[model samples]
Target: MNVDLDTAKEGLAVLQQYGGQAAAAAGSLLAGLASPFQLFEGGWGLNLLFFGVLGLLAYSLVVLAPRQ
Candidate 1:
């Protein structure tokens, strides 16, 4: 009975450690995904700038592409 209790406690400790790591990983992933939209959170000027930069980048890619 004592051995069984020790084994169960060890198992629970390992599970808790893994669970904490998983939660931290999930939070970091969410923050990374949300970072791109943070530029738009600054309102109209930032939004315009973001779109303008994106457009310029796209135009550059098209203009600089090699002919097939």
Candidate 2:
């Protein structure tokens, strides 16, 4: 296949721009998810509560998953 240099460069630019946007979106999503964990830093009680809740959520998901 014959491809023009300018056309390839334009395609690469578009891909790079899309990748950057995707990275930014992923970063924001992770930051939002992690924001709640910051509360656990206040004390050991909060840390234990956070882990307990997380464990319960994990267990529920496991119990509720579909069986083949």
Candidate 3:
């Protein structure tokens, strides 16, 4: 069996579309993970403190630490 140029082009286009969608989804997930305040909204009290601590921990663990 043999494939033509048009079929290969169409396949590539489809792959590109899927790749774009996956990238977009990954970006959204990262954005959501970047903010913990939104997920645990509290009215300027212990809830805010809790979220702040969580955010700090996440930053220190992920950003401050060196990865191999």
Candidate 4:
């Protein structure tokens, strides 16, 4: 059995569509992971304290550390 050029082109187009969908799904997953605040929103006080500590740590790293 032999395949022609049109069949090969259609196969390539299908592969490209799947690749694009996979990329979109990956982006959505990363967006969900990257937000610390939105993940713990139900407990307001705890969320505030958690983010405050994160901010403090970031500030300490950026501001108080000696430049190398």
**Cα TM-score of candidate 4:** 0.51
TM-score of each prediction: 0.53, 0.58, 0.51, 0.51
RMSD to native for every prediction?
6.5, 8.1, 10.3, 7.2
Instruction: Judge candidate 3 against the unseen true structure and give its global Cα lDDT, from 0 to 1.
Output: 0.83
lDDT, candidate 2, 1-68, per-residue tens = 99999999999999999999999999999989877776656666887787899999987788766542
Which stretch of 10 consecutive residues in model 4 shows the poorest summed lDDT? Answer: 34-43
Runs in model 3 deviating more than 4 A are 37-68
lDDT sort, best first: 2, 4, 1, 3
Total backbone collisions for each predicted model: 0, 0, 0, 0
lDDT of each: 0.84, 0.85, 0.83, 0.84
Q: Residues 18-50, candidate 4, lDDT per residue (tens digit)?
A: 999999999999867765546475566776788
What are the per-residue Cα lDDT tens digits for candidate 3 across 1-68? 79999999999999999999999999999878866645455454766787789899999899888663
Better of 1 and 2 by TM-score: 2
lDDT, model 3, position 53: 91
Total clashes for model 3:
0
Considering TM-score, which of the candidate structures 2 and 3 is the better prediction for this target? 2
